[model samples]
Target: MNLHADAVTVLSAWAPSLGSQESLRQAFLGFLATRDDTVQRSCEAGHLTASAVVLDSTGTQVLLTLHPRVGRWLQLGGHCEPSDASVADAALREATEESGMTGLEIGAAPVHLDVHPITCSLGVPTRHFDVRYAVRAPAGALPVRSDESDDLRWFPVDALPAGSEDLAELVNAAVSSH
Candidate 1:
Protein backbone atom coordinates (compact mmCIF):
# COMPACT_ATOMS: atom_id res chain seq x y z
CA MET A 1 0.00 0.00 0.00
CA ASN A 2 1.04 3.60 -0.43
CA LEU A 3 2.29 5.78 2.44
CA HIS A 4 -0.97 7.68 2.86
CA ALA A 5 -3.06 4.53 2.91
CA ASP A 6 -0.67 2.93 5.34
CA ALA A 7 -0.90 5.91 7.67
CA VAL A 8 -4.67 5.84 7.54
CA THR A 9 -4.78 2.17 8.44
CA VAL A 10 -2.31 2.64 11.27
CA LEU A 11 -4.11 5.59 12.76
CA SER A 12 -7.47 3.87 12.46
CA ALA A 13 -6.24 0.92 14.48
CA TRP A 14 -4.62 3.14 17.11
CA ALA A 15 -7.47 5.56 17.66
CA PRO A 16 -9.79 3.17 19.41
CA SER A 17 -7.10 2.02 21.78
CA LEU A 18 -7.01 5.51 23.25
CA GLY A 19 -9.63 4.59 25.83
CA SER A 20 -11.85 7.31 27.39
CA GLN A 21 -10.16 10.12 25.46
CA GLU A 22 -12.80 10.38 22.79
CA SER A 23 -11.83 13.83 21.60
CA LEU A 24 -8.13 13.13 21.13
CA ARG A 25 -8.80 9.83 19.44
CA GLN A 26 -11.44 11.35 17.19
CA ALA A 27 -9.18 14.26 16.33
CA PHE A 28 -6.50 11.91 15.04
CA LEU A 29 -9.01 9.84 13.12
CA GLY A 30 -10.54 12.99 11.70
CA PHE A 31 -7.16 14.18 10.53
CA LEU A 32 -6.61 10.90 8.75
CA ALA A 33 -10.02 11.06 7.16
CA THR A 34 -9.81 14.66 5.92
CA ARG A 35 -6.11 15.05 5.24
CA ASP A 36 -4.90 12.55 2.70
CA ASP A 37 -1.43 14.08 2.81
CA THR A 38 -1.13 14.09 6.59
CA VAL A 39 2.02 11.99 6.51
CA GLN A 40 3.90 14.33 4.23
CA ARG A 41 5.96 17.33 5.25
CA SER A 42 4.20 19.53 2.69
CA CYS A 43 0.99 19.35 4.67
CA GLU A 44 2.11 22.86 5.88
CA ALA A 45 -0.47 23.63 8.57
CA GLY A 46 0.59 20.50 10.38
CA HIS A 47 2.06 17.07 9.84
CA LEU A 48 2.41 13.75 11.61
CA THR A 49 5.45 13.35 13.85
CA ALA A 50 6.63 10.46 16.04
CA SER A 51 8.39 10.44 19.37
CA ALA A 52 9.37 8.05 22.16
CA VAL A 53 10.05 8.08 25.86
CA VAL A 54 13.29 6.11 26.13
CA LEU A 55 13.69 4.22 29.38
CA ASP A 56 16.77 2.51 30.70
CA SER A 57 16.92 -1.26 31.00
CA THR A 58 15.66 -1.21 34.57
CA GLY A 59 13.04 1.31 33.57
CA THR A 60 13.94 3.71 36.35
CA GLN A 61 15.63 6.39 34.30
CA VAL A 62 14.63 8.06 31.06
CA LEU A 63 16.79 9.45 28.28
CA LEU A 64 16.00 12.95 27.05
CA THR A 65 17.51 15.43 24.65
CA LEU A 66 17.78 19.16 25.06
CA HIS A 67 16.21 20.20 21.78
CA PRO A 68 18.04 23.16 20.29
CA ARG A 69 15.00 24.72 18.63
CA VAL A 70 12.52 24.05 21.43
CA GLY A 71 15.17 24.63 24.10
CA ARG A 72 13.65 22.05 26.37
CA TRP A 73 14.63 18.64 27.68
CA LEU A 74 12.20 16.42 25.90
CA GLN A 75 11.80 12.90 24.60
CA LEU A 76 13.64 11.86 21.45
CA GLY A 77 11.68 12.27 18.25
CA GLY A 78 11.18 14.30 15.12
CA HIS A 79 9.43 14.62 11.78
CA CYS A 80 8.62 11.50 9.81
CA GLU A 81 10.71 10.85 6.74
CA PRO A 82 9.69 9.23 3.47
CA SER A 83 11.52 6.07 4.39
CA ASP A 84 9.31 5.51 7.43
CA ALA A 85 6.75 2.81 6.67
CA SER A 86 4.42 3.49 9.59
CA VAL A 87 4.03 5.95 12.47
CA ALA A 88 5.49 3.39 14.88
CA ASP A 89 8.43 2.88 12.59
CA ALA A 90 9.04 6.60 12.51
CA ALA A 91 9.09 6.69 16.32
CA LEU A 92 11.55 3.83 16.51
CA ARG A 93 13.79 5.32 13.84
CA GLU A 94 13.86 8.67 15.57
CA ALA A 95 14.65 7.06 18.92
CA THR A 96 17.55 5.12 17.43
CA GLU A 97 19.04 8.07 15.60
CA GLU A 98 18.71 10.54 18.47
CA SER A 99 19.78 8.12 21.21
CA GLY A 100 22.67 6.61 19.23
CA MET A 101 21.71 3.17 20.41
CA THR A 102 20.88 -0.07 18.67
CA GLY A 103 18.39 -2.78 19.65
CA LEU A 104 16.06 -0.53 21.57
CA GLU A 105 12.70 -2.22 22.10
CA ILE A 106 9.60 -0.32 21.02
CA GLY A 107 5.94 -1.24 21.04
CA ALA A 108 3.45 -0.81 18.23
CA ALA A 109 0.87 1.19 20.18
CA PRO A 110 1.26 4.82 21.06
CA VAL A 111 1.39 6.01 24.65
CA HIS A 112 0.24 9.55 24.01
CA LEU A 113 -0.81 12.01 21.29
CA ASP A 114 0.00 15.71 21.26
CA VAL A 115 -0.54 18.67 18.97
CA HIS A 116 2.01 21.37 19.49
CA PRO A 117 3.22 24.35 17.46
CA ILE A 118 6.84 24.53 16.47
CA THR A 119 9.21 25.90 13.89
CA CYS A 120 10.17 23.25 11.40
CA SER A 121 13.67 22.61 10.13
CA LEU A 122 12.82 24.64 7.06
CA GLY A 123 11.87 27.56 9.32
CA VAL A 124 8.17 27.16 8.67
CA PRO A 125 5.67 27.60 11.44
CA THR A 126 3.56 24.50 11.90
CA ARG A 127 2.08 22.16 14.43
CA HIS A 128 3.13 18.57 14.99
CA PHE A 129 0.56 15.85 15.50
CA ASP A 130 2.91 13.79 17.60
CA VAL A 131 2.40 10.13 18.35
CA ARG A 132 4.57 8.95 21.20
CA TYR A 133 5.59 5.39 22.06
CA ALA A 134 7.47 3.75 24.86
CA VAL A 135 10.99 2.49 24.15
CA ARG A 136 13.46 0.68 26.33
CA ALA A 137 17.18 1.23 25.87
CA PRO A 138 19.61 -1.63 26.09
CA ALA A 139 21.35 -2.21 29.36
CA GLY A 140 24.21 0.19 30.04
CA ALA A 141 23.46 2.02 26.81
CA LEU A 142 25.15 5.38 26.38
CA PRO A 143 23.60 8.00 24.15
CA VAL A 144 25.69 10.34 22.02
CA ARG A 145 24.35 13.77 21.23
CA SER A 146 23.02 14.35 17.73
CA ASP A 147 22.91 17.54 15.68
CA GLU A 148 19.30 18.09 16.68
CA SER A 149 20.09 18.28 20.37
CA ASP A 150 22.34 20.44 22.52
CA ASP A 151 22.86 17.60 25.01
CA LEU A 152 21.63 14.08 25.80
CA ARG A 153 21.42 12.45 29.17
CA TRP A 154 19.53 9.94 31.28
CA PHE A 155 17.72 11.25 34.32
CA PRO A 156 15.77 9.59 37.08
CA VAL A 157 12.19 9.32 35.94
CA ASP A 158 10.89 11.03 39.06
CA ALA A 159 13.68 13.53 39.42
CA LEU A 160 13.77 14.79 35.86
CA PRO A 161 15.46 18.13 35.32
CA ALA A 162 13.56 21.34 35.86
CA GLY A 163 11.05 22.37 33.18
CA SER A 164 10.41 18.78 32.17
CA GLU A 165 7.02 18.25 33.77
CA ASP A 166 5.42 17.47 30.45
CA LEU A 167 7.96 14.78 29.74
CA ALA A 168 7.46 13.43 33.23
CA GLU A 169 3.76 12.94 32.50
CA LEU A 170 4.46 11.05 29.31
CA VAL A 171 7.02 8.89 31.02
CA ASN A 172 4.63 8.15 33.85
CA ALA A 173 1.79 7.27 31.49
CA ALA A 174 4.05 4.96 29.51
CA VAL A 175 5.58 3.29 32.53
CA SER A 176 2.39 2.80 34.48
CA SER A 177 0.81 0.92 31.64
CA HIS A 178 3.61 -1.63 31.37
Candidate 2:
Protein backbone atom coordinates (compact mmCIF):
# COMPACT_ATOMS: atom_id res chain seq x y z
CA MET A 1 0.00 0.00 0.00
CA ASN A 2 1.03 3.64 -0.38
CA LEU A 3 2.22 5.64 2.67
CA HIS A 4 -1.04 7.56 2.98
CA ALA A 5 -3.08 4.39 2.72
CA ASP A 6 -0.88 2.69 5.27
CA ALA A 7 -1.37 5.59 7.70
CA VAL A 8 -5.12 5.40 7.23
CA THR A 9 -5.01 1.70 8.00
CA VAL A 10 -2.97 2.24 11.14
CA LEU A 11 -5.12 5.04 12.52
CA SER A 12 -8.38 3.38 11.59
CA ALA A 13 -7.40 0.26 13.51
CA TRP A 14 -6.43 2.28 16.60
CA ALA A 15 -9.37 2.58 18.98
CA PRO A 16 -8.85 5.80 20.89
CA SER A 17 -11.74 7.39 22.81
CA LEU A 18 -9.93 10.52 23.90
CA GLY A 19 -10.92 13.74 22.19
CA SER A 20 -7.33 14.57 21.28
CA GLN A 21 -6.69 11.16 19.76
CA GLU A 22 -9.93 11.29 17.85
CA SER A 23 -9.20 14.74 16.46
CA LEU A 24 -5.75 13.65 15.46
CA ARG A 25 -7.12 10.61 13.68
CA GLN A 26 -9.43 12.79 11.67
CA ALA A 27 -6.73 15.33 10.94
CA PHE A 28 -4.33 12.60 9.85
CA LEU A 29 -6.89 11.26 7.43
CA GLY A 30 -7.19 14.71 5.90
CA PHE A 31 -3.46 15.21 5.87
CA LEU A 32 -2.97 11.96 4.00
CA ALA A 33 -5.52 12.98 1.42
CA THR A 34 -3.97 16.39 0.83
CA ARG A 35 -0.26 15.82 1.41
CA ASP A 36 1.88 13.37 -0.49
CA ASP A 37 5.02 13.76 1.58
CA THR A 38 3.62 12.21 4.76
CA VAL A 39 6.94 10.44 5.42
CA GLN A 40 9.35 13.01 4.06
CA ARG A 41 11.30 15.52 6.16
CA SER A 42 11.31 18.18 3.45
CA CYS A 43 7.56 18.50 3.48
CA GLU A 44 7.11 22.16 4.32
CA ALA A 45 3.47 21.71 5.09
CA GLY A 46 4.09 18.85 7.57
CA HIS A 47 5.03 15.19 7.83
CA LEU A 48 4.65 12.17 10.04
CA THR A 49 7.02 11.72 12.98
CA ALA A 50 7.19 8.84 15.45
CA SER A 51 7.96 9.07 19.16
CA ALA A 52 8.20 6.71 22.13
CA VAL A 53 7.21 7.23 25.74
CA VAL A 54 9.81 5.12 27.48
CA LEU A 55 8.78 3.79 30.89
CA ASP A 56 10.68 1.85 33.45
CA SER A 57 10.04 -1.82 34.15
CA THR A 58 7.63 -0.84 36.91
CA GLY A 59 6.03 1.91 34.83
CA THR A 60 6.37 4.43 37.65
CA GLN A 61 9.05 6.42 35.86
CA VAL A 62 9.51 7.73 32.33
CA LEU A 63 12.57 8.65 30.32
CA LEU A 64 12.60 12.13 28.77
CA THR A 65 15.07 13.95 26.62
CA LEU A 66 15.78 17.66 26.88
CA HIS A 67 15.47 18.47 23.21
CA PRO A 68 17.97 21.18 22.36
CA ARG A 69 15.89 22.82 19.67
CA VAL A 70 12.58 22.72 21.52
CA GLY A 71 14.24 23.02 24.94
CA ARG A 72 11.64 20.84 26.54
CA TRP A 73 11.67 17.56 28.39
CA LEU A 74 9.94 15.39 25.87
CA GLN A 75 9.63 11.76 24.83
CA LEU A 76 12.37 10.05 22.84
CA GLY A 77 11.45 10.32 19.17
CA GLY A 78 12.38 11.95 15.89
CA HIS A 79 11.86 12.11 12.15
CA CYS A 80 10.70 8.98 10.33
CA GLU A 81 13.58 7.49 8.40
CA PRO A 82 13.24 5.73 5.06
CA SER A 83 14.27 2.44 6.66
CA ASP A 84 11.32 2.47 9.04
CA ALA A 85 8.82 -0.12 7.90
CA SER A 86 6.09 1.24 10.16
CA VAL A 87 5.44 4.11 12.56
CA ALA A 88 5.94 1.80 15.53
CA ASP A 89 9.30 0.68 14.20
CA ALA A 90 10.47 4.28 13.98
CA ALA A 91 9.44 4.91 17.55
CA LEU A 92 11.16 1.75 18.79
CA ARG A 93 14.37 2.57 16.97
CA GLU A 94 14.43 6.11 18.36
CA ALA A 95 13.71 4.95 21.90
CA THR A 96 16.49 2.35 21.80
CA GLU A 97 18.96 4.85 20.38
CA GLU A 98 18.16 7.58 22.89
CA SER A 99 17.61 5.43 25.97
CA GLY A 100 20.51 3.09 25.34
CA MET A 101 18.29 0.21 26.39
CA THR A 102 18.77 -3.00 24.47
CA GLY A 103 15.61 -4.88 25.45
CA LEU A 104 13.01 -2.18 25.05
CA GLU A 105 9.51 -3.40 24.32
CA ILE A 106 7.24 -1.12 22.29
CA GLY A 107 3.51 -1.41 21.82
CA ALA A 108 2.10 -2.03 18.37
CA ALA A 109 -0.54 0.69 18.45
CA PRO A 110 0.11 4.33 19.04
CA VAL A 111 -0.87 5.61 22.47
CA HIS A 112 -1.13 9.22 21.38
CA LEU A 113 -1.20 11.38 18.24
CA ASP A 114 -0.27 15.03 18.10
CA VAL A 115 0.31 17.61 15.38
CA HIS A 116 2.62 20.44 16.29
CA PRO A 117 4.73 23.05 14.53
CA ILE A 118 8.48 23.17 14.69
CA THR A 119 11.65 24.17 12.85
CA CYS A 120 13.54 21.40 11.14
CA SER A 121 17.28 20.95 10.86
CA LEU A 122 17.05 22.40 7.38
CA GLY A 123 16.00 25.70 9.04
CA VAL A 124 12.54 25.47 7.59
CA PRO A 125 9.36 25.86 9.59
CA THR A 126 7.18 22.77 9.48
CA ARG A 127 4.63 20.76 11.34
CA HIS A 128 4.88 17.19 12.63
CA PHE A 129 2.11 14.63 12.87
CA ASP A 130 3.56 12.66 15.72
CA VAL A 131 2.59 9.04 16.33
CA ARG A 132 3.63 8.12 19.85
CA TYR A 133 3.92 4.59 21.22
CA ALA A 134 4.57 3.20 24.66
CA VAL A 135 7.95 1.59 25.25
CA ARG A 136 9.07 -0.32 28.34
CA ALA A 137 12.69 -0.38 29.35
CA PRO A 138 14.43 -3.18 31.20
CA ALA A 139 14.77 -2.79 34.94
CA GLY A 140 17.25 -0.13 35.99
CA ALA A 141 17.79 1.08 32.48
CA LEU A 142 19.72 4.32 32.21
CA PRO A 143 19.43 6.70 29.29
CA VAL A 144 22.37 8.21 27.46
CA ARG A 145 22.10 11.63 25.90
CA SER A 146 22.53 11.75 22.18
CA ASP A 147 23.42 14.66 19.92
CA GLU A 148 19.72 15.38 19.54
CA SER A 149 19.28 16.06 23.26
CA ASP A 150 20.98 18.23 25.81
CA ASP A 151 20.19 15.91 28.72
CA LEU A 152 18.50 12.59 29.37
CA ARG A 153 16.85 11.61 32.64
CA TRP A 154 14.14 9.53 34.20
CA PHE A 155 11.33 11.16 36.17
CA PRO A 156 8.58 9.74 38.32
CA VAL A 157 5.50 9.36 36.20
CA ASP A 158 3.63 11.75 38.43
CA ALA A 159 6.52 14.17 38.81
CA LEU A 160 7.69 14.93 35.34
CA PRO A 161 10.03 17.83 34.86
CA ALA A 162 8.55 21.20 33.98
CA GLY A 163 7.35 20.97 30.39
CA SER A 164 4.34 20.78 28.17
CA GLU A 165 1.04 19.50 29.55
CA ASP A 166 0.88 17.24 26.51
CA LEU A 167 3.94 15.38 27.77
CA ALA A 168 2.17 14.57 31.00
CA GLU A 169 -0.87 13.36 29.10
CA LEU A 170 1.28 11.15 26.89
CA VAL A 171 2.85 9.61 29.99
CA ASN A 172 -0.55 8.90 31.52
CA ALA A 173 -1.80 7.20 28.38
CA ALA A 174 1.38 5.19 28.01
CA VAL A 175 1.41 4.21 31.67
CA SER A 176 -2.17 2.96 31.61
CA SER A 177 -1.75 1.08 28.35
CA HIS A 178 1.68 -0.46 29.03
What would the per-residue lDDT of candidate 2 be over residues 53-138, giving only the tens digit for each residue? 99999999889898888888899999888777778888999998887778999997889999988888658888999989999998
Each candidate's number of clashing pairs is 0, 0
Clashing pairs in 1: none
Point out where model 1 deviates above 4 Å. 15-21
Model 1 C-alpha lDDT per residue in residues 1-178, reported as the tens digit of each score: 7666766676667653446444666777788678778877778878888999999999899999998877889999988889888788889999999988999999777888888887786578988888889998889888988888999999999999999886766888677646
Give all TM-scores, in the order shown. 0.91, 0.94
* Highest-scoring model, lDDT: 2
Best-performing candidate as measured by TM-score: 2
* Total backbone collisions, model 1: 0
